[model samples]
Target chain A: MKRVPLSPLRAILARQLRLLRAERGWSQERLAAEAGLNRTYLSAVERSEQNISIDNLYRIAQALDVSAARLLTDL
Target chain B: MKRVPLSPLRAILARQLRLLRAERGWSQERLAAEAGLNRTYLSAVERSEQNISIDNLYRIAQALDVSAARLLTDL
Candidate 1:
């Protein structure tokens, strides 16, 4: 499969997600389970291969106990 | 003018921007200038009418002195 290039926004989001998850010392699987998301989907998002919905973002943010704005501040 | 309905993501972004700005007691104009963005554009983003780029978001986050990950955690 051809790897699609991520847009600047997607790349930023991917980096931010990884950083946030790391800061919390949570593995991807734990974060995904806490956020009520699939591990594979979370992995895809972190890799910038998926376009996630706002609801999903909200769920993830809630799981992380942070505001959505913080997640978006970087783009 | 007909006000277009905001997507869930847009609404979340707008709310977060407003909340963060208020927390710092910075007006839209000051935030815009500090972030190197136009006041009108910042206003539009706060209203959820503008689709901002990742670069712009990074600038805003820098101006606000917050990590990009915090802004995205609530995604």
Candidate 2:
């Protein structure tokens, strides 16, 4: 794996995503299905290895039953 | 110019960006320079024609001296 620099914002997003998913006891596959996203892509996002667009962010937030802004909280 | 469908979240972002820039009396070029992004790319984003990643969003938020979550509000 090519080691890539992690973005601070992405790191925040990763932590928030993981926390949210764990709270609901949903596996990444489960969340991916709910969000209509590929499991691999969702996994990558949780790892902070993907530079996801706002569209994906919105979808994930929606699937997690929250506002997109909620996921972006704490910047 | 091909018309791409606008995303609801992107529309919110565009409106917020424009409002923020206007509040500061900064032109798009000025904000782009402050954000270390291309002027044309910022312009496209303002028009809701860009699929901007979180990295770009972070940069813009930092340039505007606001939290990324602030820009994402009302979504």
Candidate 3:
């Protein structure tokens, strides 16, 4: 299957999410659990294959103990 | 038809988008054009009826000359 390229914003979000999770030393699975999201979905999100909705971003931000805005700021 | 209640985060985004647009004295149609989104879709987003994707949020932020994080921040 051909892989679709991520939009610049989505790429930024993916990097931000991975960085935040790394800063906390949390595994993707653990963060997914905290965010009430499926682990596979969260992993896909970090891969920039998902155009994650705001509510899901809020969930990840809440799990990371950061503002959703923080995840979005670099864009 | 029954209206769905906005999630708290979505509601905040709606209010923030509207506030920012109002602050710039831009009408919804104008902002939508600037953001390259359909006017009706932008209107629904402003009304908290859309769970806007991160990419679209980025477009709106770019249009408003605000950080995407700024829109997602209140959550």
Top of the candidates by lDDT:
2
lDDT, residue A53, candidate 2: 93
Every candidate's DockQ is 0.11, 0.38, 0.36
List candidate 1 stretches off by more than 4 Å: A1-6, B1-75
Error of 3 at B30 (Å): 0.8
lDDT tens readout by residue for model 1, A22-51:
999999999988887889998988887776
Q: Write the per-residue lDDT of candidate 3 for residues A1-75, one digit (tens) a residue.
A: 212234577778888988889989999988988888889999888888888998788788878888887786563
Give stretches of model 2 more than 4 Å off: A1-6, B1-6
Q: Model 2: which residue pairs collide?
A: none
Residue A43 lDDT, candidate 1, scale 0-100: 95
Question: What DockQ score does model 3 reach against the true complex?
Answer: 0.36
Best by TM-score: 2
Per-residue error (Å), model 3, residue A53: 0.3
Kindly provide the TM-score of model 2 when superposed on the true structure, using C-alpha atoms. 0.89
Q: What does candidate 2's lDDT look like per residue over B5-57, in tens digits?
A: 34578888999999999999999989998888889999999998898999889
> Judged by DockQ cut-offs, is candidate 1 incorrect, acceptable, medium or high?
incorrect
